[model samples]
Target: MGSYRWNWPILLADPYYGWIVSGFGNTCLIAVLAWSIAFPLGSAIGIARTTELRPLRLVGTIYVEVFRNIPLLAQMFLWYFVVPELLPQDWGHWVKRDMPYPQFLTSVLCLGLYTASRVAEQVRSGLEAIPRGQHHAGLAMGLTPAQVYRYVRLPVAYRIIIPSLTSDFLGVFKNSSLALTIGVLELTSQARQIEEYTFAAFEAFATATLLYCAVTGIVILAMRQVERRTRIPGTIAIGAQ
Candidate 1:
């Protein structure tokens, strides 16, 4: 066999080192902000969709249908490039000049809104899955509508929806990579930088794939723990024979 050569200098001297770290940092930041925004908005929209108020339900339905039907890439592009132009000229200029990390912000908004649509559907379905008797008992207890939801409906709905929501969270995390197209410099972008600098396509791509797999695996494991702890009492255990 030829002499094994592990070039430490080549690894250390890779020109895109800064890009790799920066991209990973931005990916995490974007995913966190987007999830923070999406969860609350989605919960609210879901509650609205199930509310007695026709107007609120209609509005929620429209929002869900519109965003859910559209592509996330299109949503990001609209927020970043198209939204400013459609605004009044002075406001457009102000937005362009004043918005720090505009691509980051756009990624968050787009991902949050898009993911919220899916979440609303999940929450709605979860709420419906619970027995109607629970709501009747809450009302009979003289609980206000808000109280009924807070103390009864929402908790159970959320518990029931955990599995689906876990999947949604994973989807949001993966979609965060698309932010790179608008210059958010996430993991995939970092991998590209490494590839360009070292011309070691296999190594760079392998590193990126492993990193993503690790991140995803950790999230899935954490969510499984949550599922176990929060599971409805006396229900058959998930993954049980």
Candidate 2:
């Protein structure tokens, strides 16, 4: 360690800086895209798990169990390598070769599905946290079960789970680093590339560490604001905080 020289400026120098910037952008983009898929789908699955409908609950349970149990790295590999081959031959070929941004798209899908299972659980906890009286009151007012959820339950449940959802949102950003495995060229990938080119492993990764910390820190602060603003008085969400 005493003999090693640190070239911190290399990170801010030509090409390397650009790589960092674009990689950060890609990471953010992938997280946002995956969250788009995760939120609504996970909400539906969570609602299903709570519904009186047996088949819906069964299907939702299977989905959550299968996805949540599988390792995310394995899922990433399967989406990029195996899923394409499973399609019709021509379609497979297109997916593997002709498709634009295949790695990026695959990363988005893999992260989305993997994260949705966890989000479903958060939503379920949120739903269950609601007092039974609310559901009963809605029903007594002639609201269908679906209408009750659509109005009273869902709105309150979402607010109740804001902190949990914030955690999941942060997880998406961190998990996006795995996209580098399939060549999405996200932040981690760029840091590695910089290491390869300049042999400044410490500097490259140090910068990356700082950038990741900054981004996640910002996310935490922003989410806290959202949680505070959306928080319902006398709720478990606040009590837990």
Candidate 3:
């Protein structure tokens, strides 16, 4: 048998090979969509976790434990397969018919919740790190609880926690590969297809590594830019003092 040559031009032009680009696009889409949901939800969960109300704290704890402990792959499988069956018969039928993208939805929900647990923890830590005087000052300024969080607590907490949040985003970007297990056709999944068709393990994997690195590098760079733009020079100094 002749050695199969790597054809760069063919890789670029072939639609099947184009799946790699499309896969990266799809992966980015999923990550953004999941984060959009996760950020607000995670912030709320974090607040609940820190609330003075005992019941809200309990609910937040349970939410974090349930989502965080469960494997995300298992959650995806549950959402895609088990949920429809477990629903009421009419609802199941409706979901089966109307749910055009069950796998994608499952991927988003699972990824969002998984990431949110982490974000929740980050937010909680950020809140705890804030001086108690900040909350007191907000109250003294006649801010409602909501106003206190909105105007004072969140601003400081976010500033303090951004470095941690950047790490979390990078982690989620990589973890998105898990969606391929449920047929979401992300970068890794597309690479598998290329390997199947060309039997070019080295080429296929090499392409994937470069693509992932490019995306991950961009995210890191963007986060660093955000950090530099928003950073307060005296805040860390003040905290230390």
- RMSD, every candidate, angstroms: 2.7, 1.7, 3.2
- Which candidate has the top score in lDDT? 2
TM-score, prediction 3: 0.91
Q: Candidate 3: count the clashes.
A: 0
Q: Rank the candidates by lDDT, best first.
A: 2, 1, 3
1 versus 2: better lDDT goes to:
2
Candidate 1: 10-residue stretch with minimal lDDT: 1-10
Which scores greater on TM-score, model 2 or model 3? Answer: 2
Per-residue lDDT of model 1, residues 68-142, tens digit only:
877888888888899999999999998899988788888889899899998999999989888899999999999
Error of 1 at 86 (Å): 1.7
Off by over 4 Å in 1: 1-14, 237-241
Selected candidate, larger lDDT, 2 vs 3: 2
Clashes of each: 0, 0, 0
Deviation of model 3 at 185, angstroms: 1.4
The candidate 3 region of ten consecutive residues with least summed lDDT is 232-241
